[model samples]
Structure formats: structure tokens, C-alpha cells
Target: MTTELLTPAEMADLVGVSVDTLRYYERERLISGVGRADNGHRRYDADDVAWIRVLRCLRDTGMTIDQLRHYCDLGEQGVTTKPERLAMLRDHRAKVEARRAEIDRALELIDHKIDIYLNEAAGDAP
Candidate 1:
């Protein structure tokens, strides 16, 4: 099925966020500002929807608003900012890896706690 051009509500529904949150992203300049209708209501195209998807993915991966703004600024600057953008991505990647390691440690701790509980229930202390 062909995707329809989305209104703010439709876009919010598609992206699984509130309309207010989408407006906040626009205010923060994280996503492209949607065009307006004759009545001044925002009209979002498929491109805007796609951009929100990418923004959501970045946010899910722990990219901060500041980072996203910086990336967006670099993107707006075109090829002249390519090197800086690459550096930013590389730094973010390192941070993500560190966070992943921390998560792994937390998972191990939870597993250890569960194992201890299981042992106690079994009358076999570990």
C-alpha cells in the first residue's frame, strides 16, 4: 500500500509518540520542520516521516538531543562538514560500546542474583 502524506497526528501515530513530542522535536530543530497548509496546519510528507524514524532510532541508541542537533547542523552544512560528522559518529560509537559493556555487567549482576535466589530456594547455598 502507498503511504499517505501524514498530518502531525498521523505522523505521531506512525512514530508511536505524542503529537506534543513531535512538536518538541521540531522546536528543538532535531527533525525537519514540516510545511504548512493554507490554514497553517503542519503537513508532513513521507520524507519527514522517514526522518522521524531515523531520529527515533538514534534516540533509542542513546543519542542525546545535543548530539542530534549537532549532527543535524553538520548535515545542513553539506559536504564541508563531512570530516566533523565522521568524527562525531566515531565518538558516539565508542560511547555506545562503553554503555553496552555497562549493560552487560548489569545483566551479569542480575543473573548472579537470580542464581543466588534459586540456590536458596533449593536449600543449596552458593
Candidate 2:
């Protein structure tokens, strides 16, 4: 079956981002394969949506625009750049993991405070 091409609004809704953000991604070259309708409206195919999802993941994981641009450039370079792409992703993963650990520690502290509050409210605290 052929995938349905989506309009800009539909794509933005599906991707849980604004149309302006989608345009920004296109302008930044973070996503590719976006088509245009005869009326000059932007159309997105499944492949474009998939690439946008990857861009969202990288952006949400704290990758800078320049870093993402470099990654996109590497991707466009074909199979020969696989090693470099892998290295970049690996490094990014490590950074994400480190941030996760920091968030976990902060959550533990917040939980401890909540427990203390609960104990005080329940008259079980010293």
C-alpha cells in the first residue's frame, strides 16, 4: 500500500510539533524528502516523518543545532560515513545517560522531601 502524503498541518499534528518548527527543521536541513503540492503547499511523506522523528529525538536529547547539522551532513554522505555517525550517536548517548543520572538524583531528593512532608502531616515524624 502506498503511504498517504500529509499536509503541513497534518504533519505538524502527527509529529506533535508546530508547523513553524517543521519549517525550521526543513530550513536547517535536519529533515529531507519533503515534497510540494501543485499549489506550492508543503507535503510530507512517511520517510520525511520518520526523519523528523529522529530529529525530534536528537533535539530532545540535547543535541545542538550545529551538532544535528553535522549529523545530517554525515547521513547525506552515505554508507562511508557510518562509522562517524555511530561515533557521534554513541557520544550523544553517553551525555544523555549522564543527564538521566543527574535527574534521577534530583528526583530522589524530591521524593525524600515528599516523604518527610507526608510523615509530618501524618504525625509520624520526630
TM-score of each: 0.86, 0.89
Model 1, span 1-126: residue lDDT tens: 645667888888999999999989988989875788788998888889888998897788899999899899999889999999899878878888999999999999999999989889999655
Worst 10 residues of 2 by lDDT: 25-34
Candidate 2 regions with alpha-carbon error over 4 angstroms: 122-126
Clashes in each model (backbone N, CA, C under 3 Å)?
0, 0
lDDT for predicted candidate 1 compared with the true structure: 0.88
Cα lDDT tens digits for candidate 2, 46-77: 88888888888989999998999999999999
lDDT of 1 at 82: 97
lDDT of 2 at 17: 97
Off by over 4 Å in 1: 1-3, 124-126
- Per-candidate RMSD, Å: 2.6, 2.1
TM-score of 1: 0.86
